[model samples]
Target: MNATVIIPAYDPEENLQRIVDRVWDLGNHVIVVDDGSDISKSDIFHRLSEKAIVIHHEKNEGKGAAIKTALKYIKENLWDCNVIGVMDADGQHLPEDMEKLVMKANNRENAMILGVRSIGEDMPLKSRLGNAITRFVFHSLSGVKVSDTQTGLRAFSYKLIDKLLQVEGTRYEYETNVLFYCAKTEVPIIEVPIKTIYHDKENSCSHFHAIRDSYRIYRDILKFSLSSFSSFILDYVLFCILTVLFPAGGVGILFANILARMISGGYNYFMNCRFVFQTGTKTQTALQYLTLAICILVMNSIFLQIYAGIFQIPVYMAKVLTEISLFVISFFVQKKIIFRHKVSGRGMIKE
Candidate 1:
């Protein structure tokens, strides 16, 4: 299978050696990145050097950097390697599980394989709670549902190395961004059920700062959501105000709807470029956004007609339904089309 296993170790212990030895025994090459662990942990890496290619950083970088380091090494040196595996060094992942992921990668045409764990009572409480709270980050932003958004155990073909390196994130958020990258690029994610092994149930060795790193992963989407919500409030409130001022009927409602959208859409476009998506107001991007806005406006009018004109529902209730229905579609369109990222040849995000 010509697979290479990459383990990013920070103050790892006996299990690191065990995983390396077992992977080597299974006939897979291993690359161990010493992510600036203390001098006390040097010996473990030294011993691993005999069984694997050991790369050390003088200072601590994050897990994302370590994985990129190993990927770069593979892309430069090991051209024959067809499959690449990445796993945590804290002993939560079993070598057999890694083998399953690698095997799955080999069979898949163009997809990243995830060794997804069952999040339940058997797992850490923080992990369980985090997954429960944060799966929305994936489904809401990318319009893709991933069972394990933060699983460290992942395998992909050498072909995806460039795109993965291009994904932005340095620490824990890197894993989350990788999933987003795959979703963006139309790379399928194949999840394989793996054993959920938590070596220490309480106070685990994971370096994931739950609150801090989670914010990094969710920050962009959170800001965009707030921007969208604020824009909707402006749109709806102004629609109501204009309707009252005219106080006509269906005709007044239509006029108010268009007027409110023009105001709120302008605010949304500004906020998305300046604050939410962080994109420049290039002409092409502006044109694309305008097209989307027009399409959404038409869709909004149709929904309002169905709700208010035909069904005789209150215009107020119809406005809420129309906005809610379009939220996900509008967000995804703006993200995928209007605010797309550029990828460099060596896998860096240019903007």
Candidate 2:
């Protein structure tokens, strides 16, 4: 695969040597980014510098920054390297599992590979719950169903590296940022099984404060959720205004509803295009969204009329019932059709 393994180390006290040895055994070049670790204390990392191309950051730049540096070096060198794998410096990431990821990356040179941890067995309670929350956030915000959104054992093709380098976050939340970027660029993600080996004695781990880091990840995906809420509010407020102005039985009702939907839909399109997806807007993007909105409106109106007229349900209650049904179609249309962000990185969403 002509692959290169990039490991970003920051005050790494775990089994870094073993990881280095294993990457070498796999017959892949290694790039260790020492993220401002004290040279005196990190003697082992210093020694391994001889075996791999070491990029030292005098200041402790975050993992995202370290990756950005390594990616630049790889691109500048013009390495024939097709696959790039990354994992933790801690002994948690097994050498054998990494090989499995590399093999998968070799076969699917165009996909992003994720090493999914089988945390179902012997997992810490805090770790499990934290991962669950992150997983929910990922699916809700990105429309991508992923379980272990925070797993460190990941691999990506060269094409993905080019895109990943453009991501903005420079901390532990960088992985979360990558997920959003991949979604935007249509990166294929698949997950392979992995084992969690937590050998931290005092658990005085890196600066990855779970609460603080999780908040950052949440913030990164907030744009999508916020955009959706904005659209919902716009639709609801406008619908109310139209209903009051036109009254239910007037001919003006249909036109008012349709116009209100278009107004709200426009707000959603612009927000999702610029903030959520962060991609260049296609000429037909707006038309596609409008079409979807029209379909939703028709479905909603039909359901409402049937329920309110035939079933004798209250008008407001019928509207609510219809809106609930529309949720499924709206989600499917946005995920599978309209905002069809293809996953490039290979990984399964697990919790």
Candidate 3:
């Protein structure tokens, strides 16, 4: 199988030439993207250009943009290439591990292969903590358990290139976005255990900004939750107003809950469709969303009754608890079932 390796470099370390030479020894086409490295690094790229295909960005666009640029060049130039591998320019990813990823990709058809690193005591505390938090959040959002969500070593078939290129995020979050998109689209992901190597414990050569990039990585989830929160506020306000305006009884509570949910659910659906999920074919998605809303409405009313009537919790408190519990359920259902797109073939959604 014809394969090409893409290394996205941004102010790389001094050992770049060694990394390129090692990758070249694997007998695959190598493409190195210089993401606007400073003039001091000019000699490095200049020397490496003779050994590998080098693409230069006028300015630092971020790792995702660099990878996209390499993929674009490959699609336009290397028509015979079937597999594309992406790895960091730093020496963290061993050449042997990448070869294993390539082998795994070649064996599997239309799959994205990830070189999963075993997080051990030797790993930096920040790296370990960051990966742990990201893994948990990713699993909660995408329903996919990935050991190493931030690993730079990954391989994918050419068939998935177009979809991956279209994935949102131009920074560190781009990798996380790829996993989310793949999980949502039902793209097969194969994980292979690989070696973990950190250059420096405290101050690594890595360019990842923990705070700024973490926000970017979790941006999608934040947006979705914010939309839900806004709808919740509207729903709660309407429910409170109706409860005050109506008699205190089962019939009154049920009536108020249904009306509140219907209004807020409609608003929530509109926001989710336009911003959160961004699925095509509103007819089917709306139907599914409405069905989900009805289900949640029933559950919400039951919980409200149990909390407010049986447990003697205040009606407002019961409503708050019930909605909070239902919020988690709603997010999963919408992500996995309601807004998931059905691809025709090879799991590629058309633009």
Candidate 4:
């Protein structure tokens, strides 16, 4: 299969030549998306164009935008390319490691290949912490454990071209968003070992702003979690209303309990369908609701029976404890299975 290397460059006229030479030497086609680099530096991309294709942007768009442009160009031109790989222009990724990534992509052909970096000596402390947090969220939300979620060195088959084009993030966060979209679509992904090169820190011109951009990444993960939190609030409110209407007698307690959980379950289903899953929330139909209620009833019975037997806790107090436990499990399941959104990022140099 024909392989293509996509490099998103911003004012990297000097570094561009070095990267282009390495990629060209590998016998792969190269596409450089210039995110509004000045024309006076034309000689750089112009020189590389002799060996590869160079597309220039008049205004500086985000890295995500540049990738979209390059992919679109490939599709429109009908290039006979199969695998597409992305790398940074700031010289952070080692050229030699590209072989492993390319080979892995070729082998898998359909799976998205992530080049997991071997974080060795002289790694920045802030970068380390940020990558760790991103990795945790990716695993927790999507059930996919990745060591480096923010690595720029990733390879994908041309079949994913249409999928990547459908993604919305226009900045650095776009990388993470694509991973989420892939997870949502159930596309297979694999991570391969690779080496990273950190130049004596002088050659890095990364625009990633840690604090500001991290907030964006965190905000994305929080969106999927809203359904569970919403269910908890709904449950509590329903319980309060039921208790107000009927005192804590046998009949009052039974009716109140059933109604509270039912209302909360319905609300949770509604929100998850429209907002959280972004797919049809009603996919489960009435049977799904009935099944969910049955599960909740069974859980409630077990918890209430255990509490009544061991501890002399009141029914209301036992119910509260059961809800709390369910909340924890619901959050984990919603993130990991139902509304799982995998996110990966290399941090942001800009807000």
Candidate 5:
């Protein structure tokens, strides 16, 4: 595959050497990022650096940062490399599995190839539950079906490095964002089954901070879900109030719905800007958001007018039905267009 393998290490155990050796034996250049491992671990990195390129960090950065560090290195020195790959230093990812990803990427240069893991009964409880939950939520929100959302063994055309670098997250969350971004951008994904290995029974080698990192990974979507639900509540309540006061059902539905949507949309926009998307760009955001809200409002009005006005459905029932139908569309627009995350870098990139 003419690939460069990037291994991100943070206080890694002896298995790091074994993995590097295996990768090197496979005839691929290896780059290891010593993500601020302990001083005692320097000897291992030093010895491995003789064969594989080793980059050291002054202090501990998250796994995502380590990967990015390696990616930056690849971008500058190994731009001619055909493929770029990432594997875990924790020893869970096998070199052969990595090769599978690289080969698949070689076949499909336009797609990102993932070495998906099989979550079996033998896997640790936390690992199993974590993968299952993350995989489900990721699919539900992004509409991308991935078997293992957290698999570190992945490969793609060297061209993808820049796109990945532009993504947010310097921790576990970064990988999740990568999946989300690809799904949003319509990037093709090819998954290949890979062998799952756990050196320890408890999977204790993983440095993932269960609570802190989980929150980091799911924060954006979590906040967005909360903001959406709350906005819906406010919208529903306002519609009820307006209906009671003005006594509108058919044609009156348009007036009542628009008034309620405007108010709720304002609140939703405020929350998304300040908290949910955390978008930093000031250009055209107001105009973009206004356009999306208008679209949603129009859709909502039509649904209500048709359901409650023509069919004589109850106003509240029609309102609920209409809002539910528009929910996914509104969320998609806000996420993909109105409040998309700003890329950290500019220009063409991939990995």
Candidate 6:
């Protein structure tokens, strides 16, 4: 199989040359993206250019942008290559592991192959904890159980290149975005076990910003749910206000529930469209959201009545329980049905 390996480098250490040399020896075309490294580091890329196609960024673009640039280059120039692989310029990814991913891609023409590392006891504390959290969050959001959600060593067929390029995020979050996109689009993923090599500590030469990048990554995947939570809070507060204004009987509770939902549901729809999902035509999304709101409204009213009216629980506490019960259901429905078109595959989604 014809394959091209893309290495996105930003101020990489001297070990980059060795990585590039080994990758070249693996008998695949190589592209090294110099993500605006400093002048002193220019010699590293200059030397690499002799052995591989070196692309330069005038200034530092993030890793995602650099990879996108390389993908664009491949699309425009080396379109004949059937497989595309991405690996970090840092020495973490072994050329053999990358080869394993490539071979896996050759077999599964429509699947993304990841080089998953075992997080052993010897792993750094932060890395182990971070990967565990990210893995859990990724599965929660995407319903895809990936052993390594942050692995840079990945390979996919050429058909997926355009789809990946369209994925949002321009930093470390971009890698996580790819997984979300694949899961939403029903794209298959295959994991290949590989050796875990951490030079010094995991963060020794790594450019990953734990707090900032973690927020970005989680924000991208959880924005919809977070927005829904905000709307839920508004909905609950409105419910409480309406309950206070009206009587404490079922009639009063019914009115308060409907009116409060009308207000908060509208806000939720607006926020989800403008900030969360951020795609699909306004009319179509509104229609779908309207349906979802009605369903949740019914469910919410039933739960509130059971908790507050029949069970005689406090109205405010009942409201919280009702909203919490429907939170996961609402998010999944809206994401899978309402916003499916946003990240739906080009021709991959089955009608």
Full-model lDDT for every candidate: 0.86, 0.75, 0.86, 0.73, 0.83, 0.85
Where does model 1 exceed 4 Å of error? 229-264, 278-351
Tally clashes: model 1.
0
Writing each residue's lDDT as its tens digit, candidate 1 over 309-346 gives 99988989999999999999998888867887632222
Q: Provide TM-scores for the models.
A: 0.76, 0.73, 0.89, 0.77, 0.75, 0.86
Look at candidate 6 and give me any clashing residue pairs.
none
Per-residue lDDT of 12-79 in model 2, one digit per residue for the tens?
Answer: 77478778888888788889899898866478777788678888999988888998899999998946
Query: Which pairs clash in the backbone of model 5?
Result: 159-350, 160-350, 160-351, 161-350, 161-351, 162-349, 162-350, 163-349
Q: Which consecutive 10 residues in model 2 have the weakest lDDT in total?
A: 342-351
Error of 4 at 274 (Å): 0.6
Return the lDDT, model 5, position 119.
79
TM-score of 1: 0.76
Better of 4 and 6 by TM-score: 6
Per-residue alpha-carbon lDDT of candidate 3 for residues 30-123, written as tens digits (9 for 90 to 100): 9999999998999899899888999999999999999999999999999999888999988888888888888778877677789987788888
Which 10 residues in a row give candidate 6 its minimum summed lDDT?
A: 342-351
Question: lDDT of model 6 at residue 265?
Answer: 92
Per-residue CA lDDT of model 6 for 158-195, tens digit only, reads: 99888988998888999999888787777777788888
Is candidate 5 or 6 superior in lDDT? 6
Q: Model 4, 1-351: lDDT tens per residue?
A: 688888988777487788888988988888998889877777888887887788898998878899999899889885688888898888888766776687777776667788777654466666777788998886666665667778888888888899899997777788887776766566665777776767654324676777766766666456646766777678767876897899766567567767888887888767766776565654544455456556776686577656744686877687778776666566565555454444333221110
lDDT of 5 by residue, 1-351 (tens): 578999989999887889999999988999999999999998999889977999999998888999999999988888678888899998888899998788777777767777877778778889888898898777656656778888888888887888999989998998888887777666676778888888676889899899999999888678988998999999999988887777554556567778999999989988988888777546598889898889888888888888876888887888888888987888777775676643322212222
Q: Indicate the residue-level lDDT of 235 in model 3.
A: 98
Ranking by TM-score: 3, 6, 4, 1, 5, 2
